[model samples]
Target: MSILLIDSYDSFTYNLRHLVENATGAHVLTIHNDSYDLPREKESLNKLVGSVDAIVIGPGPGNPDSAQDVGIIPYLFETFPKTPILGICLGFQCLCLAHGCTLGYLEHPVHGQISRITPIDRNSLFRDFDTDFDSVRYHSIYISTVTDDIIPLAYSEDQCLMAAKHAQNLHFGVQYHPESVCSEMGSKLVSNFWALVEKRETVPIRDSHLLQTEPLIKHFKTTLEYDYKYEKIPKVDILSACERFPDPLLLNSALSPGEWSIIGLPEPGRSLVVGNSREAGLTVGTWKGETKAHSDSLWSYICNHMSQRYYEPTIGDPELAKCPFVGGFIGFLSYEESIPLTVNKITSGPTPSTRLCFVERFIVSNDKHTFVVSIRPRDKEWIQQTKSQLQTCSEPRFLSSVKAKVEKPDKKSYEKSFYDCQKYLHAGDSYELCLTRQTKVHVPKTVAPWELYKCMVKNNPSPYSCYLDFGDARLLSTSPERFLSWNNQLSQMRPIKGTVKKHPQLTYARACELLKIPKEIGENLMIVDLIRHDLYQMLKEVEVTKLMSVEEYQTVYQLVSVIEGRLQDSIYTGIDLLRHSLPPGSMTGAPKKRSVEILCHLEDRIPRGLYSGVCGYWSVNNHADWSVIIRSLFNYEDDLCSTGTTRCFRCGAGGAITVLSTCEGEWDELNLKLDSVLGIFS
Candidate 1:
């Protein structure tokens, strides 16, 4: 059987796809609603309906009454009256609106929250389920009135219309999300819907664009996780060993430029990955590392490279095999670059959109041991020199303090944007929009970038802290949020959304109290659902292991959630997952595409550079880990700026804006986030 899922640019559409596939084992195809104009041509509409036995309208943000928000959905209702159709949250409201039903605002909107619901009748969609159950709802408007032809199937505890079916047409609608991880009996609901679908003889159409065969996995026959002999790349030559872990800040600063990265700090760093470019190593783009010739988009090139070098790691030294980074590409994808090149046309920038280094020689340190090894035999000399440098490395001192020229987003301008955001929110344009601004700081030549990095970590230690020197640009990040991480079996994403600035008087209990409110919880929940959607797109099973929990950081207390999904080796690889889930949802906000579109105009259409991007490594062991580039400082040599005595540094900060947000509160949050890094200068 085949099903056509019409996506309205929502994050949860794939979760629905996963649910439907698991329920009926049907071949599901998805297309955006905007793919067709209103009144789809007679020939095109016939072809679209003939290809599938059933059609599904997925949920998304924005009002159903707006044509711009729901493209061709109303037309589909009229064009295919006989086709089996199912409508979800936004889709449910659209179905009611098409049948002369009106929507009413909820007294209190619920997003990423669960509510009790009961079936009025033994409807096919709720057959054999519990009498009363919890379903996840993410809507601000409910169907207030039902037409005489509409049969009510279920209702919420508050008497809100939850489910209905058209008496005249073979159509059904549900206000609650059956695909949500928190929803109960969701699979049964989807299976019941499929059972009611009228079975008809239809030609199996080949959707080459939407349905492709899963990629084949190349298995390696080796006992060790990394088979240097099997690949014939080189042998691991350990030149040095540090009995006691050295300060990453000092050790990283001593390395000479090529392309270098330090993934953790001495204070609170975990799963440390430290490496620099070597003449024998391989490099891509303009950054340091070994040299390689390539002409392609950055993401595709990395994806292709990782695919060829993919390996299976099993039955080795447990500690060594489990290392997150076992020598691979280390770099970032800028916010502007994360947008597909076809969509993002404005390319003016001082640095490349992506910069990565293939480190053959690097350091991998756990709590018990730190090993400096090289995969390339040619890097023996450089590895030895690196060992000598770290042994003799001394703490660097700053000659002068960094100074801020000015904050680009002054309070008046920020307030204007804040009100504008409210306008969009009140109109149901966006449930949550992450707004960001950049601050420029000036530093003298005498003060090295490494010294600044040291100061930043000393003041505010973060788990994903890193220092990157790409010759043209330098980035120092102390971000607490793990954008995404995956090993051989599973992938995880930890997104931090709510923050409470630390003060002497505030205790951990007090901070938790402040963050457990409606606004803070809503902010975190939106991102959690959005990320679940992203993971469910490719992963086989996704679960929210942690939801809306408070964690204390150096400068602030943040609310974080952990989402994990099992990896299907034959289908998508870690690189494929990275390519699909770019520009982390936490940074972009919920209803990601729409929120980003709105953010561009609000932030003056300027490239965010490296501020809201991702920084981490794609390891050779088929393991990867990345962190959102928040609480970061980036300095580059632009042609417009002077290079003699002082250089310009840029830092970006922002907060999520919702209907409950105030201009002053958002501004204070923005500053509080900025101060986490900006305080380093003082």
Candidate 2:
């Protein structure tokens, strides 16, 4: 069935659509009216009456008392007496005005407000309205006085006419919104309204809905609250809890939890889209029923659509920054997504492209009290179950200890590829080419993915590190590079190029000597320029905030640089900025486009997946922070043939190669990047 929904300039109209469609199981078509004005033509009103089964006049920005404003509501009231109509907030005021009542401005206007209402009398509209019905109120005007024909259904603390219904007709109006999450029985109230048209029994409708990911989301939220939501437990305790979870799909961040540590996932009613598809995060960009397909080709329109549906509503609010996934999405960009932009399509891996909705189960976080955290906890049952699942690796039949034999190309083959890239540099086909290869780990079957993640975090702690799960394919990332970070009008990128092998024995004087090499400094300068070029497309007033600075990690001392820029007013979306700077310049080399093409041909097509890609959060306010998906282990567990210790794992590692790059030294650079990650192999 079709419902004609007239939008009165409420930025939150479609959010109601998500609730209405889920509650009524009907399609809702919307038309935005200007200043509360609907189509006045006789033919237009006739067409609307002929087409729709019911009408929903939505909430809006202005007072309904204006003679010029809300003209259509009164017009429709007289013209279509038999049609079913429900009004909320502004529309409710219009209903009062049409029925000979005046609207009064509240002494204190409530914006983004939520309040409770009690049903004083029973009406056909509030079938399920129980004691103390929770309602969300966000309007400044109230139905001041109603004629004897208008009957009151509910009242608030201040004695406002919170709801009204026609004495002789089916017309119903609610002073408070039942569509918002803050309104406890909002979905139920909406469901009853729909049942009025269907003439069916009203069923229980949940205010929130979580798609296919509900199981993982449920386990994560429940376990997270049960374990570390309040207390600041040791990091290991959280890890033990996450490892007990039943599902293979999970996400973990090595961040310290404080206030945001207790956030639970939003329910399905909060989402416009829902899915439970299980595909790897690395190679999959969009899975069936899970998310939309926005290939590089469709990205422009996708961002445009998102800006309107997700961003426009957040323009001037003081709390504009806290809304999650306003028009945001979170997932991985496989190394292969940009292959078409770089070299020809090299179908390197069997994984498909997948990206998930940040619309449902959403979270909004900033750097302070509300930090974006990735916590992984097992099922509450814990230890005994964890023991049975210990051996997740594909090692030999006999159980063995720590030392893991690297199973990929030999040292000679890596040096050979290094020289192959050098030939391209000499030919002037590339500037700097980032070259990389994956080294597989083979060991005893007893290696738990959770234990390996804990070890990786303990040894190499990074600000943006995470354990991203995609069911069978999981990524344990400890990346140090910030490909891009957008916070409101500001944009940033931190690229690490120059590397110095760090060891306990190496003195500061000796390490300084190694780090001061001209070659390393040149590499850092080169990529910064490439990054500057990439950022210039979407940003203005671009500048380097930090020159080559040394960030000391546990095992490596690397030269890092930060580029900052003001987002261009014309650039409303940053996904294009992401596409523009993809496969990150530090990983692809200088003169990015040409360098990436050269690497694809020179290094042999190794499936990059999450490696060299990125993972982070995206907020509706056009804000984001992403880390280069590097120094990560990709574990591909075979479900059918899988027994204990039968999983295939690879740690992808690489570094920048310039014309001055030495073939012998490149492998060592790659090895140092893999240094901390190798503990997972142990």
Candidate 3:
């Protein structure tokens, strides 16, 4: 069987596609609603539609009244009246409107909220189901009245029209999202739809007519090339080397000659990976809004380099196996590198939008042991020289204090943006918008980047903390959120959404209660759905392993959720997964593309730079890990404050803005996040 899913640029469209395939054993082809809306593509779209067994109009943003929103969806109903059709959310609204029904605004718009779905009658879509079931909803409009030719199948707890079908046509519509993780009996519901599709009487297409779908088939098919090889190098105890030259001293000396990337966490869960471009390493960078060639080469290099692994095989130390990185590409991507820009152009910054170094020599440490390793055929002599320096090294005296200045965000400007986000929410432009503001910090040039990072780590240690210096740019990130991480076995993403500041009156239980509120949970749910959409693109059997759990960080309590999926190595590489799921969903709001567009305008075309991007390493051991660059400080060469001796940095901070977000509440949350990083200066 075959199904054509007409996606309306919604994040949950893939979830629906996967569900339909699982329930009906059909090959599903998904295309954007506008993919074939052009006059030139109409005939091809018709041939494509006729080739499929059924058609599904998926949910999306915007009202059905706008032709721009619904695109060719309305055309499908008129042209193919006999085709079996199932419409969801925005699609449902479009379906109802075509049959002479009207859509009205919901008094309380629900996005990422679960509601009880009560069946008006046991139709084919809800057959053998409970009287009432729960399903997630993301809509601002609902069908106000039913047409005479339409049969109402279900209603929500609040008595809104939830599901309906045409009396004589093979068309069905549902107002809620059955593809959501929180929805109940979703598979059974999809199975019931399959039954309806089979029972409908329609003229079958000839086998010769089916050949017209070749173009569509080719569009969905993905081809991957791989060539795996391994080579062995040398290894040494990192702590033994660090014993004479501790991190403060060792990193300080290393930073002067070349670019450096460090990913470290505190002891107990302690692990640190440091690599530099001192020898046999290439320092490559792509500027903001640069052509795709530069960034593409970086991603291509990671894939090729990781596939051709170089390692020391004789050192079959079990401790080495536990370490995630042995030496590979270490770098950071600026926020602009991840998403399609809605604005015309991004003003070029002093540093590149993305920077990476192919590290041939590096040091890695875990709780029990530490080691310095290298990739073979190069960096051998450099390792010997580094070891000699470590042996004779005297602990460098680090400066205790550095004069600094902070430029706080203007409150009136922030509150105005908050209101602007609300206007978009009410207008159905977005369900949740992650609004952010940047704060400026200035420190004397005498303060070393390593020392600044060391102090930041002492103040706030995170699971994905790092100190990155790429010649022109430096980043000190103490982010608790893990954006994406995957090894040979499985891939995972932990997105942090809700936040509760730690206080004398707050308890763990109290924070739990606050995080579980409908508003907070809704914010997290939107991002969760967005991430599921991202994973489904390159993975199979995606699962939300943990949902809305309170995780305690150093200074605040955060609501974090874990999503995991396995990557089929033959079909998709870790780089493919990383590249496709850019600019973490937690940082960008739901319905990613639209939300990013809105953010660009609301933030006044100022590029977020590296502040909300991701920083991590793609390892030689076929492992990749990245963190959403939040609660972090970053500096570009030309962006320094108004003095020759002072070097300035930017810290981006914000909260997710939903319909329920208060102006004052969001302002306070933004400041609370800033303090976690900016406090080190104090």
Candidate 4:
């Protein structure tokens, strides 16, 4: 069977064709009114209509009043009264006029306005309609009144007839456009219409014309209420879920309960033949920590390590060869005081009262490297499990290994030191000083080859980002820096450039202080300026909704700002704007191209994989949220086996360095950043 689609614009036809074809799996023949004359179009359409099973009039910009003299609607009804016909937007008005309904133009046609459907009667066309779902209206002229023979299937809140069906004829029309993505029940509406048409082709005419009266209003009302009340629900018991999972890395914790999970497998690639039962407990919550600097430090350390050991002239010049794989560095932040709560409860071993330190886990070259530098947990189970996992992996390296030879510090002394640090923090003697570090892993032989291809292809395609949180812990890491994410809107970018570190004792504090410096602040401000400029190009009015501010995250503190603007009516696809303004100012530094040159000249690698790229999703309403792909990894299939290593990860880190920046200090700061991930190994 085939369908006839009449549209004034090509875009409407392009979008609706997919929906119609997908629903009915039937051939679609489209006719553009503006391009074809009525006489020629009529001759062609007449022959096509007879062969097609049904006709669908698509939505488009144009006045139905202007097209009334064309007589296309009358021709269709007269030629194919027995065949089912559906009208959308302008076509709906024309259909109503053809069926003796009146149409008039409003002074202001509510374009892009959402109109709620209030069904007036039971009918197949309004099967999914009640009082809940809203259809997007994009027209100036609407059906003002209908005749007695026409059934008022749906109406807008303002009492305008949005949809109607003829009582004696197989004709239906909707004032609102359902072809656009903005139409809430568009897909369902099209599906129902096609189902009705299919039934008519098989059953008796009377049997196929039966109307449905069971109201779906209650279900829709409950759904809307639940969506509205979702935020008010209390958080679930995360600790119990974690205990059930046993792996701290895979616990589920987020704002919405039962929505997300953290899955932990052997880093890079670990072949575990376990089924869903074993994998179910291995998922956890998101991680809340800021470790960009630490990640940078780790990358620097890796470069240095490669320079000393893996560097080879034969594999192409070290300076020119792009890094083959992407890398990921994660800093899991926890409240400083919370460590003791989990540490003291260990059942099998003596609990240490040592100052809690950050952990670092690195995935380089596919293999995982975990480091535990400063704060050692007293829990034997936690420590033992971590050690066992590390040892199982080949060529594991350990730093700061206490030989169990030095006499253990007494609990009194350790507790006193802990309180001393806490006292100093509370008294404002010092800002909350958290330890940080980075770890470097050689992308194991298992998952290394797919790196180069991914880097080349994803240069700057779409703004991409992801957030997975399931109650116990949450991971809010995206390479692209998403400074502010709320209400289906997002502002993020890749921020790079660094300065040398000063005052060895005040690294963390100095890093925080430098972020506030006017020079750095101005650079960030310039990036915001560029973003605002880009936003204003697509939106009506732009606003710097958030000013530059220091946000203290788990492992590191960052300077974040926000900008917002009202989207323009003319702007259809946001991906175009995202593609045009990419490799964000934060990553490129001020005077973007110059910064890239400097980076290429200074850094030892190229194509930072998912490190500097962006990834995220866009909703059906054109509302979008995305993030920079910084602390992330790309997992690829291993060449050796079909089901071999399929996971690879990459993380990128750098800072704006002025003339005052020293190489050694930069190296130390980089290492400090890498500490958090490396600590995870220990």
Candidate 5:
């Protein structure tokens, strides 16, 4: 049997797809009804209905009547009257209305509420259903009148017609979501519906969504569950120890360019790095399972999941006043979802483009001269072994064998892409599109990433810098642009949008003059507005702490903006804040959503992987920060490598192309932005 699930886009649509597929083992195809008709000539109405044996309309907000013109549901019922049909929530109201019933607004709408369901008729559909069961109902509209052709099968506590089976055909409508995990009887209800479908072909019964690595909220009221202490280790010692073992994962950050650092080292084969929230503790290359392609929803789940976990905590000595979540999620997401703002996903780049991570042992720095080692109560041995490793640091390791052989994009190709971005800007599809390109580097295995990281910091350092080895790949990021930062203590975001590369010949006045170009200012304003909207999702009143301000970096000066909002609610965690602001605005362009869609289409729909994503840490104190994945070295193993030692490394850069953007100008900006990374190779 096949089931065609028409997605009306509820927050749980992804969950719905999984439930229906796992429950029936049916071939299920879900399409966003709103865009199903895109490219109408190719996806004609007939082509969509050719393979399905049944149509299941999933739940979504909004009235069914309002969606009549966007979907083929009404026509499908008219053409395939006998095909098994099921309507869930909005879907139910939709099919019900098509069958000639009138709908009414609920006196009081219930969203995410558990309500009693009393089956009024012992229809075969309710064979195993309890006389009164619980189900989740979230709706503002209800079936006010059931025409003679429709028989009400169930009612809510308020006597609302919650479920009805069409008397004339195999059509069934249920206003309550049987698939919600919150409802105890949801699964049985769904199963029963499936059973009915089988008996009639069939008989049936029915219904129904982070990274929960550690507890999201800090336990300040509860006694400190862990203890801490610090050590004054020589830099040579820590560096020497890390060199001895190249097999373990390393996440290191510096207090300054080359001195003082906090490094988190996880035992080999025991811990991992994650990019997608769905896969926790699984390193980059080992992830074979599917992830939520829906970027927005995926982020929400990741934040909620990570915040709620009670991961063992690592206590710091004297505790750095900033207690970041000792061990939690880290990594980047590919902005490849076919969101409304972007074109559909049509690219198949096999790179594990999304990576997130969880850390266990942390070696932190309180002062540049002093450091602390934090781990769970039982991880004393691991901590000691780490310290012991750092103890052997007098000699330097020979890591660089060959320089990165960089391959730049064809000038014309990039110019063409820049023009492509402008086309969208002119079309109003996006106000400021971050169009990026990368240089492919054929790297030697002996050219160690850690060594390159050292060079990057020495040559060009930033406020947010990180170096991580994810087994399959290593990331050395030194980004001045902070995508988002949250202090369970406070909520704010620092986004970098404008740019002006610095040079010996350029005076401070001249640099500031170039940064003040009208186009740069306009681009910054467009992104600031979009970012303010993002912050507004969590905060009722977001404030622009800084605007059109210039922040100088080692290689360039950026037009930076600071926006903050109150996180008065303690229920939110760093994860929650990130979800509302992933694939940072500066990278996505103004009108973030549509711009992503536009870029996807222009980039051949290939996943940006870590190129435009984020790299950062959730602090032990419940604060977190991530750098935009720009001006970073991204490397990974390749099967195409004829030599085992051959690897692929990339340094990426892009600029926001506004209507005022010229191909030559965007191309030059990209080159200047990436000079920090590509220059290190020279």
Candidate 6:
């Protein structure tokens, strides 16, 4: 069963979706009340009303008396008598008029203020409630005379009826908007409505809409009874302390045959899956089973360390191109029986060490997988040097070894298939089209693995950066600006886009000075402008909460800014925002779609996969936190290897420009970025 919310305005829909879904787990569809230009006919109203189990008249602007003349109200009362109906605010006034009640206009309507609600009688809708409670009131029209058949369920202390139920039909109305945060008993009202719709067997109705006399007291008692103690268990160590590991880049090539299956690991009992079409992309387990914090918080924790460790140092000495350390981390929650896994930090282990850190786990579904990752020093220096050394010791692996199979359609048939897919998109069947194209790039030996690694290390501003030395296969690496993530009402976005190269004459301090140039600021602003525009489409008036500023990173100083926007009324799912604003503008140049097209034409591949894709979790409440997957490697089972062993390694790199970027400079920068992952090879 589903509930259709009609004419609902912004963010209000978000709260309503949450309320209804949580109470009954029913599908909720929201339709903009004004967006539809339906002919005011009884048949039109019936058709709209017939599509759902219940029609909730959502809160919106305009006088309630005006809506009655428009024909929706009269049609509802005259035609659909059996269908359950609900009205909030203006919706309530319309309901009263439709039920033969008179709407009396107030000289001055009190808006957005608290009022005392007094219960009139015992009913299932307000089954369990106290005699009185406070709720938000925002209406100018009052139901002066209710019909004989309608029973008054609740009224304000001033004698204005706040809630009424039809004795003859499954119809209800509330003058007070129950969807607002100010509605003290709003959630209970929704729950009661669900019970009625779901036809749950009930014993008897009680007076009052508020259930518990003191819900806060019960909550405190419940909190105190909860236990946090756990028994210490034996930890499992990796088989060998210093096994000669294969190239991290080769890991994906080795494990490609598995096609990224999700599996529950034994020791930690966490689900693990690796294999995204892109070398660094992710289709891993869901993040819902992990921590409760927002995604931006996690990104801030990681990026803050990256800025201090890698960018700051690189800015001081540009020649120091190699920082042989890099790692990835994931935070999540699993089953109660699953134990948290801890790996050695390698603070003083091998010459070049890296670690990925997993914070804490949260929730896991019966069929879903959950796991967290951690990589240490979380600085750019270690990441760059590690990759440089790793590359010097290894050979470039071919693409065929790791590339997933692509089935091409015949030329004549491909167009038809493409159009069908396009039709699906236009009809809102899918948000994105995932397709593949073959491409290649020349790998010059001048920028050897270590040389390139050093260049990137010297140039990078974050302590934690990534490098992908795909060799002739065409390199794709990324240094990301971890964007916004949210769980429920909380949401955030971090934007970073500014760069300065290390020249022989430029000292680390000089490089930081260079980053403050106006041209660089313009570039950063362009991306910010684009991001704000994209956000505005699905969000409310977005504010540049954090102005553009230069923050010191490991190797250099970076120009960073924070942009914030409130989610729209209809946008309830985190995935919805992701689908609309993906391949972050900071990473992709301004005019995102055009930038992508230009990259596709100039670069070697389409569908960069997880390399530029996001990884994170979406919780039960539709809140999510995801990160752009950079400075990471993929592992997979290799059937072609003589030893039949699985391969594992990481990939990293940066974006490009056709006009301003020279071939040699671009090539050098690419090498610099790859040094982090390559350093691990040596």
The C-alpha lDDT values of all candidates are 0.71, 0.58, 0.72, 0.41, 0.62, 0.42
lDDT of 5: 0.62
Q: Once superposed on the true structure, which residue ranges of model 5 sit more than 4 Å away at CA?
A: 1-229, 232-261, 272-305, 308-319, 323-325, 334-350, 378-385, 388-402, 639-643
Query: lDDT per residue, candidate 3, 262-288, as tens digits?
Result: 322111112222221211123332322
* lDDT of each residue in 224-270, candidate 6, tens digit only: 21111111112111111001122122111101111111111111324
Candidate no. 1 TM-score: 0.85
Distance from true location, Cα of 497 in model 5, Å: 1.8
Write down the TM-score of every candidate.
0.85, 0.53, 0.86, 0.33, 0.61, 0.35
Candidates 5 and 6 compared by lDDT, better number: 5
User: For residue 209, what is the lDDT in candidate 3?
Assistant: 21
Tens-digit lDDT string for candidate 5 (540-628): 44677887788767777778888786776645555656765667878877556556767777766544656777777664345566667
State how far residue 38 of model 3 sits from its true place (Å): 4.2
lDDT of 1 by residue, 207-297 (tens): 4334332433344233232332111112111112221233332112111111223332222222222222211122343222233544454
Q: Model 2: C-alpha RMSD to truth?
A: 23.4
Would you give me the overall lDDT of model 6? 0.42
* Candidate 5 TM-score over all chains jointly: 0.61
Model 2 Cα lDDT, one tens digit per residue, 73-98:
66666677677788887778877788
Clashing pairs counted in every model: 4, 33, 2, 85, 54, 92
State the weakest 10-residue window (summed lDDT) of model 2. Answer: 211-220
Which sequence of candidate numbers ranks them by TM-score, best first?
3, 1, 5, 2, 6, 4
State in Å the error of residue 261, model 5. 4.3
Candidate 4 structure quality by residue, lDDT tens digits, 518-631: 444543454554455444333434456555665443345556666665434433234334543455545544234333433442332223323443443322122334455443
Q: In model 3, what is the error at residue 52, expressed in angstroms?
A: 1.0
Most accurate candidate by lDDT: 3
